[model samples]
Every structure is written in C-alpha cells, then in structure tokens.
Target chain A: MDLVERIRSGNKRTLSKLITEVEYDTETGREALRELYKYTGNAHVVGITGSPGVGKSTLVARIVKELRKREISVGVVAVDPSSPFTGGAILGDRIRMQELACDPEVFIRSVSSSAGTVGRTTKNIIRVLDAAGKDVIVIETIGAGQVDLDVLNVADTKVIVLMPESGDEIQMIKAGLLEIGDVYVINKADLENAARTKSQLSLAIKERDGWIPEIVMTIATSGEGVEKLVDAIFAHKKHLEDSSNLRKGRLEAVKSEVVEILVEKLKMRFYEKFSNARYSDIFEQVLDKELDPFTAAELIEKEEGL
Target chain B: MKKGKNIRVLIAKPGLDGHDRGAKVLARACRDAGMEVIYTGIRQSPEQIVETALQEDVDVIGLSILSGAHMSIIPRILELLNESGIGDIPVIVGGIIPPDDVEELKRRGVKAIFGPGSSVNEIVEFIKSIT
Candidate 1:
C-alpha cells in the first residue's frame, strides 16, 4: 500500500516504521518523507523550555492534561542532553508525563541530544510526529541559555518558562532569552517573591524591541493560573492566524529547517560512505603532509569511480 | 524488522527522577528479546534523550519512572523527540502509576504502557507485534 494511505489510516506500526527509516537517513527514508511531507502542516508546534530547576517538566504535564481535556490529539517530543564521555543520553519522560501515554490520540516520543545539537535533532522529528495525525506537537528543549534559540526555530509559539528565584530578570535579557518569547511564563508563582518576579519580567518585556510579549504567572504544582497561561497561548496562536506577518515567520522557520536537515543528511551520507579505516589511513597519510584534503577527495573519488 | 537482531532498544530516564530499578528491568526485557540495549544514567533532560536516540538510532525509547512526576516529564520528552526528527522510536512507559491516569497518558502520546506485575514475556510479545 502507499505510504500516504497508511499514514492517513492511522496505522501505528507503519507510522513507527516510517519514522525509523527517516531516522537513519537511508534512501527509502527520503522517499518516505517526500511521500509524507504533503500530509504534514496540521499540528500546532509548541516549544517548552527553561532553566534546569524551574519545574518546566511539571508545567508541560499540566499543558498536556489541559490539551487532552479538550479532546485535542497531541504529540510530544521530550529532548534530553547526553553524556559527553560515553556519547550516551538517558531518556526518561514517561515518569513525568504519564497521563497521556495510553491515550489513542496522543503520540509521545523521547529524543536524546547526546548524539547532536538541538539544531540538528529538532527539524525532522517535527515532521515525523506532525504526519502522525497529532493535533498538537509539543517540543521540550534542553534549556541551557542561548542554545534555547534552537527551540525558537521550530515552535509556532515559543513559551519561555522561567522562575524569579532563578535570578534577576536582567540576566535573561543578557542571555538573550527575553527577545525570543511569545509567551513569558513566570512559573512557581506561589513562591515568596513570585509577584516581584512577574513585575521584573513585565519590566523586561516592556523594554523589548517588538510587540510586548505577554507574561503569565503560574504555580505549576497546584495548577494555579494554568488556564490563563493556556488561554494566553491560544490567544497568541489566534493572533498569529490574524496577522499575515506571523504566518510568514512560521513559513521562514520551516524553510530554515529544510536547509538544516539537508546539510545534516549530506554530512551523514558522506561520513557513512567514506568514514572507515581505509579513509582513516588516507587521512593519516595526509596528516604527514603527503596529501591535502583536495588531493584526498580526488583519490577517493577516483577509487569509487573504479 | 526481524524477530530480534535488527532492533536496538534504549530505556532512559529524563528529568530528576532517580528511580531506575524499573528502567533496568525493561532494559533487561529488551535485551532478552535479542535487541541491543543502551542504558543511560539517571536525571536526563528531554534534549539528551533526542540526541542519544539519534546518535544510537534506536528503535524504542522505553521510559521508566516511579516518581509521580510522569505528567510533566513525559510530555517534555515527547516534545523534544518530535523536534529532533527521528520517529521510529515507539515509546513505552513502565513504572508506578494509577489506573485512570493511564488513559490520560495515551491521550497525551504514549504508545504503550507496562504496569507493575506485567510479564516480561508479555512485553516481548507486544513489541514483536508492533514492528
């Protein structure tokens, strides 16, 4: 059967297998994506990111619950960092976002960034999940300062989750996080200085160059102000729909993702085709000043031509 | 796509949840199915899961959790995985959980759930039936 029909039919195994092929970037993988790409563009992309201890996970759980209550189909991509030494990443998302795992409408996946940067990992997976009939796809990025920009590249609405106890609001501007937020969430709002943090964020948002981003205060634990937060996001999504410019921004983001994916696939194909002991020996000879990269490429091409 | 050798399973723990005994058990089950298993240490963020899965290019990401924080962490991991671009990783959940919450998890995005006292053989067979 054709790939598009299977995807539209909601065959879980077929969806799973197609994603695997694309993950490997094989010949069929490209074909599968080409076939599946037309079926995309349906799911709303939501980005959830913050510092290490800001309770971002808890907030995500709340968001998922809220979305599910509306009977909206959801897809989630939980991004985790990797071990530098072993090149391994520990993936554990189900423990926290357990409520929706068994739901027929939701498709949750965990990705380890231990293999590559957020720039590389975020692009293709969005397509994979989007094609799987999700009404919404949530992207939870590794919140380490500026690398957070990677999330902005993919999310239709970027929600920057934050805390007051984390530090002065000026630090976020310094880190450049202030400019990227469509929604500024001051989570842990039940804390002692939660209100103060909200004002601080308000001040920071006021100073921003573009439209004044909306800031919502929430205690993610007790579910305080979560509805407003959700409403704020929906409002912003509607605003995007109303404004042609925001839609343009979304298209630009998709175009950029395509470039990134192509570059990554090209690099991977080259390494997979030429990265071996034989290629290493050629490199070693080049290291001795016997041959340059240009000469090595020539020789490798010549060998392949034979 | 074979009975075993073609698949590699990664059972990971994202976030600050340190309970890994259940994760270890699932890892063992995947291994027993003749699939290669990669286990990461505890307290993994969602980004780590996406990067590792892409690098290793595994078939499954089995998350083990005992902490009652499943709501937040699972969605976080799912969002990031979608962002990273590899989707063949059919995620399965195993650990401490209540009954009603199971349906909610399915609605949010988990492909399968392995509760306490579930047979390892049941897991193996379920996996076989999927891919």
Candidate 2:
C-alpha cells in the first residue's frame, strides 16, 4: 500500500516514481533509500563500459535478453552524458534496447551524467533496483574515455566492451581498461582481425584475485556469442563468490561510496560557506597580494572551523 | 533534501515516417531547454513508445508522426500507456496533421498537437509549461 510495498510488489509506476525521487535526491528519496537498504545487495550489478560506437548498448540489450531467457529479471541503468552548457542530455541508448522495453520483468532507466555526480546516483539507482528484486542490474556507462573508471567502483562484475581493430595491443593497455575488467567483451567480433584482438587482449590481461578475466567474443547485433559472454559473467560471479571475493569487493564498494558521499557533502558545505559577501575580504586579500591563496584558505578554514 | 528535478522527455517517430528532420529539431530544442530528451529514432511502434515512456519515467511523451496515422497510432500509444499504468504522463504529437484531426486528437486526450511549420520555440515553451 505504501511506496516500498508497491515497489516490492512490482508496480512499475511506483517504481518509476521512486527512481525519479532518487534522481532528484529528495528527502523522501533519501528516506526510501534508507528503508530500501535492508533489502539491497541481492542483484548482481554489471557495469558495461566502452568507447563510443563500441556497441555497449546493443551488447547490454543482448545480454539482458540472454538473462531473461533464464527467467532472470533485469534492471538496466544506461548512462549518457549531459550537455555541460545547458545541463541537458539526449539519452538514446534505449533505441537499441526497445525490444526488451516492454518486458514486464525488465526495467530500464536512462541516467544523465549531470553535475559530475553520476557515480553516486548510479549506486543509489542500483540499490533501488536491487531492493525491487531484480536478479541482475546492468549499468551501461556513458561512452567512456580512458581514465573514466568510475564504473569500477559501482559494479560488482566489470565488463569492458571493445571492438576488434579498435586499437593496437599497446594502445589497449595504455587505455588501462585491461586492468579493471572482470570480463572483456570484444563486441562486433564478426569484423576482420578479431582473432588478433582477442590474443592481444589475452596477453595484456593479468590474473587478479586468482580469477583470470575471460575474453568473450560477441557480435551483439545478431546476438552471436552473447550467451558465452553471459556465461563468462556468471563464471566470474561464481569465482568471486566461491573465492569469498564478493564480500571483499562489496567492502571496497561501500568504503568508496561512503567517501564519495562525504566528499560531496563537504563540497556543498564549502561552497555554501565561502560563496558569500562575507568572504569578499579574504578574496580581496588574496587578489591584492596581501595574502597567498593557500594561507587565505587556511585562515578561512580556521576562522570558520570548517 | 533537493527539490530541483531535470525534466525528462521522450521524443519519438512512430509508424512508417522516416522523415525525422522535425523530430530531431524538436529533440535538440528540448535538450537546449535543459530537458533530458530520449530520442528513439524513426519508426517506432506504439508499444515501443509507451514502454520507453514507462521505463525512462519521462515527464512527457512527444510523438512525431508524418505518416498521417495519428488517428490509429496515437490512440494505440495512449491505450498502451494506459495499460502500462503511465497514461498520466502527457503525450504530445508533432508532425503533419490536418487541423480537423487536431481537435479530435485533443478530444481523445492528446495534450497538444504541433503540425508542420510549428516553431521549435513554441513547442519547447509548451513542453516546458506542461512539464
């Protein structure tokens, strides 16, 4: 009857409303998140990250189909970058995943990477989906660049999707994607030189936690080799569980989440405190060369006990 | 405790209409207006549209149909939205539609209809007002 009850009962509208509340970071949303926390940690959160045009969305769609075939309920959180100037975005990932959109068991939410707080919001969204009882929640990151490794902390199974002939072996290693992936998905493997890419990836990927990352070749368009990718995901999940590494990974995730929250709160507090007329004296001092910026910052911190 | 929320709108082209120039223009306008626009490219079924609206939890739905199938396609989209329990989210159509059918579509619960030559600013302002 209540919000949590309705969400648990799989009321799509209520679930959607809750997600909106969460996105807005409202008081009710925070309350619901706290309430939902007890029911979280059930879904296997999968992060699908790759460069633009690497078929991350299509691969996610295919992966969800494969998951649904096994009667697993899915939640997809597709992230797209917001326009930095206008604070808007065109979340077009659903164009590829429309077939599964109508599925009663699958829920897809597009997230705009707004305000640089995408990592935190995504964590909460996954919590909502997990509490709602989705068996697997896939998070497709924004067309990522090298060093955009935020997905590393949010996902339990990190799936780095790449394409054949995308780059040479050294270029792939320089991208640092080889380090974070639990499973490597070379989507569009039907293209030329896939074998070379696979071998190249195999050489660069080092064994971590006694579980070597699996490279699964996939042509996500035709759903070729997706089942193997799914199998690889599950195998990695099993490896984590049997090795008791899942608990360890969750500990790291929680630690990062807490730190992220703290950093955001501190940033807001700092802005609220310093962005005022009262701080003009300090700014003037720094600008007039009567005080250095670092000393001025320390003075403010000491005076405000910040 | 935050109150500000991003307006999320789904702009889609339904039926056999491959002409998406208008739709793309509208989507760009909405985005520039600071609304997150989910643009599902041309030729989407009513089911796909409604399903996307529900999944994305969009504040509004804008249909761009140039195929003159508003009578059939729009109603089906509304019906599917109702069936999906998200009929409350407003649906607006923008494309080639006769003036006579505009009132008819409105009578059938379409929030608004924008025919050809409709200014992008007008449509954007209308969406901003409604959402």
Candidate 3:
C-alpha cells in the first residue's frame, strides 16, 4: 500500500516513516503530504510555547493525559534546540512523558529546531499527524523567546506557559507573545507570586474577537490544574468554532504556508544558480562598486529572465 | 537520500540505570557531528525505548546502560524492535560492557559497542560511516 493509504489505515510504522520523510524534506515526502492534505484540518493543533525551564514539557505531558482521559487520541511534536555550531539536539522533552509511552492512544515525536525557527516544519508535521488520524496535535516549542511566535500560524489554540516569580509576564506584554496567546498558563504555581503573575497577565491581556484569553495556574509535575488548562484550551476551541474565526484563521495559515514554501524554494534556487563560478563576474562587479546591490540583483534577475 | 536529510538517532537509557552522563555526552557529541539525537532520559523500559525508536523513525538506536543490566535489557530491546518491524535500525550499545560480552552483543545484532576510554570521534565516525 502507498504511504497515504497506510497512514489512513492506522499503521504506526508507516506513519512514522512518512513523518521522517516529511521531516527530511524529501520529494516522496512532499508527494505523500500532498496526497494526505485532504485528510487534514480534522485535528485540533494546540501549540505550547514558553521559555526554557518553565515546565512546558511537563505541562504538555499532563495535557496529553487529560486529553486521553476524555478519549482523545493525541500526537505531540516536542521541539528542542539544535546547536548552532553542531546542528545537533538532545530532544529531552520525552523524559517527562515516559508514562505516555505505553499508551497506544498517544504518539510523540521529538523534532530538532534545525532551521532556526522554534518549530521548523511544525505546520507540515501537524498536517502529517492530522492525516494519521490523531484527534488533537500538540506542538511544544523549543523554549520560545519573545518573538518566537511561529506557533501562531499553525496552532488553533496558542498556549503560552510561564512560571511564577519569573518576571516574564512584564516581558511578554511588550512583545508578540502577548498578541499570539489564546490561553495563558502560569505553571509552577506553587512558586511564590503565582497570583501576582496571574493578575499581571490578566490585567495586560485584552479581549480579541470577543474571546478573552484565560490564565490558568498549573503545577504540571503533580498534574495540578492541568485539567483546567485543558478545559481552557477546549473553551477557546469552542469559541473559535462558534465564531467564523476558525475558518478565517485556517485560511490565513494556508496563505502563510504557501508563501513560506514559495520563499524557501526561491531562496534555494537563487543560491543554486548564483553559487557557480560563472557568477564570479557579477560578484566582482559588486565588489568594485560598479553596481549597487539592488541593481546587481536586478541584472541577475534579468539575465535569468526571472 | 535527500540533500537535507539528517541521521536521526535515539539515545535511550534502558532499565533502572540513572547514570546518564555518558549518554548525554554522547548525545552532545552526535549532535556536534551534525546528527539529530533523541535522548529519552534515564530509567526507560525496553518497551518505552522501542516505542520511541519506532515513533521517531530513528536511523540508529544507542543504548546507554550503567546498571550492569545490558545482558538482560539489551535482548528485550532487540526483541521488541524486531516485533515492531524496525529491527533493521542498528543498535549501538555503550556504557560499561565488558570486552567478553562485546562479542555476544555483536552476535545478537548490536551494530557496535563503545566502552569506557572510547573517543567521541571514534563513535561519531562509526555512526556516520554506517548511516
């Protein structure tokens, strides 16, 4: 059977192989993804982002458990940083999720942040899992920074997890993180100033599209308040459902995905075309200031008739 | 065979061994060598290790055990991998296996074994050569 059919038939091994194909960006992977694209849009993608050591993975593990209790099948994509120098990643998020391993209802894949994004290929990975028949897919970003809001484009529910007494609440308000989160979680609530952090978040969070973001406290290690966090996620999902926001968001995501693919292809093509020794004269021209970068680029474009 | 393909390896600690320092160092070394290493942390069961390897579709599986349980745990891991139909993914064992057991492990389908005093370069070179 073909990969798409095998994935549809719930063959875990085939599903995994396809994911690897897609992760590695192979042509076969692209073909399989195109075939499986029609089967997507069924899974609810929940993106969890936070700084390192904020219990994002622990919270994700708890959320997956809560989801399973409700009879929902889950797929988790846990992203960890690849070394800038070595292009290697530890991907230790599964360490906190050992209990979920034996559960056939859950499928977890660890991804390396290879292309510099928090969750590179995350949108495509979500589609693969969605096609494989997961009910909900969770994307755990690699300890996001203020501007690492790529999750905003893929996740239906954007959850920004933070810890108490970390003073990140103030930092979040000034950045794109505040604008993207559909739900806010102050995990490690047992730490001091939990209420203060929550109140700070509440005060800064404004209503968007008639849906007010909810801040739920969670102690993810003990699974405390995770159920409430899951409820908040569902509530946000429902809010998107009752409104036209879900369709609109999906449309926007689709547009962004297409544009990103186009840009990436153009970049690769540009490098491939210009890296040859034949382009040395063009480089010399630029180095000698015979032409400005913009005009030189135009010349290259015109020479290629692009 | 794609240009962008990366060798994905699952670095697991089987049984109750908590001495993951070697595993972690090797994971870093693998990454530094431009491979994606999935470290499942310490105290993982054989079932958990197999499941992770399958799900991740890793090209290699590196087992790090210090509890002197490689004899018992490694076989169960191999058995589970075969049952899962991913037995072809090479299994490389590290961490305190005596030289006598090395031959036995290789006979049992362990691709390679790295004991103490083994350089990171040697291990990395071995993985790159194989995968």
Error of 3 at A170 (Å): 4.7
Distance from true location, Cα of B78 in model 2, Å? 2.1
Q: Write the per-residue lDDT of candidate 1 for residues A1-306, one digit (tens) a residue.
A: 777787777665566566556655556777877877887887888898888768777788788888888888887877766544443444554457655545567766665554345554465667877887888888888788445677556888889898877777557457367767889999887778878877777776652324467899988888787888888888777777777646688678778767967887777876887666668888898899998989998998798783
Give the runs in model 1 whose Cα sits over 4 Å from its true position.
A145-147, A206-210, A261-306, B1-131
Q: Chain A TM-scores, all candidates?
A: 0.81, 0.94, 0.93
* lDDT digits (tens) for residues A1-306 of candidate 2: 988888898888888888888887878889999999999998998899989999998999999999999999999999988887888899989889888877999999998888766777788888899989999999999866522477446788999898999888668678377788999989899899999999998988999999899999999999999999999999998998999999988898789778978987888987887777778898999999999999998998898876
Top candidate (DockQ)? 2
Best candidate according to lDDT: 2
Per-candidate interface DockQ score: 0.07, 0.76, 0.71
lDDT, model 1, position A249: 84
Query: Residue B80, candidate 2: how far off, in angstroms?
Result: 3.0
Interface RMSD of each: 9.7, 1.2, 1.5
Give the CAPRI rating of model 1: incorrect
